[model samples]
Target: MSAAALLSPSAPLPYSGAITDVAGIEVGHHTDPRRPTGSTVVIARDGAVAGVDVRGAAPGTRETDLLAPGNFVQQVHAILLAGGSAWGLAAADGVVRWLEERGVGLDVRFGRLPIVPGAVLFDLPMGDARIRPDAASGYAACDAASTAAPAEGNVGAGAGALVGKLFGVPHAMKGGIGTASVKVGGVTVGALIACNPLGDVVHPDTGELLAGARTDDGTALRDTRRSLLRGDVPRPLLAGTNTTIGVIATDAVLTKVQAQRLATVAHDGLARAINPVHTMSDGDTLFTLATGRVPLGEEAPGMTVLSVMAAEVAAQAVVRAVLAARAVTTAELAIPAARDWPGRRAAA
Candidate 1:
């Protein structure tokens, strides 16, 4: 069975196994195959306390500074994940405008300015470089936003995403959008990710590579970590051609510092699933949002449990991304689907 099919409704959901499983959170995607790129918006419309942790050496982001604990803005209207690298940050403008028109945002003396923090992944080389996500795309994504289960694999920011590029583009595999959630003590925590990285995606439990570099014949998997340990030098391909950006959310109330801590621990999920993560070439970032719906218990262990759950869901979401991805071919690149990979097929 394909990865998308395997995670069907019949599949077990510890929680809803989706980001939308969290109440008051809506997600939407705007995909343009012609541009072969797109954008995704996560609406915290009622406003949610948010924090970010950027681990990638190279990143493209907008308005993240405002999300800091010391910043004046205490909440954000939405979060955007898009393709087109730095150029894609423009998509946030549409999201800001969407909130503004709806009368949502921080109230100032004259008007309200919605706080929209966003990040971008490198997908320009996968398609026509000139064609990228724009303000219109962001607006459309918001318009299509829904509380229903999000469409995964080859959608939104991951539409043009390719993974395991430590070797080169030709050896990389298709990556996409994925989501998973877990419920604990009536509090639901969920994660949504766009997987486009420079290293291999691995199954956390078994340590099996789910997606990454392939053999020259494209018939087998290559251990990206193994190659690096062997001192096999990699050719300098397109640097900064990768990033994995995601958001983890919960209904549990948390302080800004705790939210930031959640984002920090969540990187453990990225490290568990991807070999050579947070490299200079990748912009691996994670954001945490708390809706303040559920009261966190008055104990340090409660935060620890939330952090552990966050990492678990993040890793699971990354695996789902590759599993759901379909192959993509462009003039400059051809990325194989994870389902077709020999290792993945055998494991399935």
Candidate 2:
């Protein structure tokens, strides 16, 4: 059985240009078979702004000046979130190289290093098990970005991503890259995510889940109700082998502390959309960049409001990634069907 059966989207929905609302926030991706996993970055002009928030013990995040609030908050030059897990952390090195070549960064006491903020998820270990993200792969991941697509599913760090692993991979659904954005108080909030979680997702409005859990034959949805009420395995048979990563981008002004707070609030969005999120095993992390143009500062309630919107966008992106994923019949994991699936054409 797989998560393919238990969850679904309300209906197929396109991005509708929501992710691109942020000014100068350009996204790039690089995917290679040798690497399989890839990376995504939101690039801005030199000396823009940034900040971050760290929630997991095993996190591989980098260049977090973007999330901190202050005069420095608005100067995020770029952000990188990638899939090699901890090994993938090197992907940011390439971004550093790129920005260095282009002369984009801050010139504080640190002697003007390229300011590329980032976050990473634990996917390589699960996707290939034996494989870990390497410097060569990181270089390859970066070299291919010039022609990269926001290509959804089975690509980048999401290349081998799977979700709802309660019964293990057999019962999991394919999940990959997804992106979304929204406007609040004239500020554009965009979320780009790599969905690799170990729990089922709910619609939020109705208690009925849209996706997750398939039968043994891989044709029908399993009853999560029974799985819960029956307690087939005592203590909820959970393994902390999952994570969700993203950056919340806005043109509003914020400090690194406020940006970090923004990231904290943004986690609420992940929690609202993803069930059983930020768990012991999942190294869930979110980064927030002030972009430093607008004059928005840290206010808990205001941050909370933005966090709610971010959560909504993040959840939608996760669902979309699953929808865009194509079921693979590989020996490691095989999904029989898709839920709330989208953008796939049947093989001719």
Best by lDDT: 1
Per-residue error (Å), model 2, residue 112: 3.2
User: CA lDDT of 237 in candidate 2?
Assistant: 38
Error of 2 at 13 (Å): 4.4
Error of 2 at 242 (Å): 1.2
Clashes of each: 0, 42
- Tell me the deviation in Å of residue 244 in model 1: 0.3
- Tell me the spans in candidate 1 whose CA falls farther than 4 Å from its real position: 1-16, 298-301, 343-348
Question: What TM-score does candidate 1 reach?
Answer: 0.93
Task: Please report, in order, the local distance difference test score of every candidate based on alpha carbons.
Answer: 0.86, 0.61
| Cand. 1 Cα-lDDT | 0.86
The lDDT, on a scale of 0 to 1, for candidate 2 is 0.61
Ten consecutive residues with minimal summed lDDT in candidate 2?
339-348
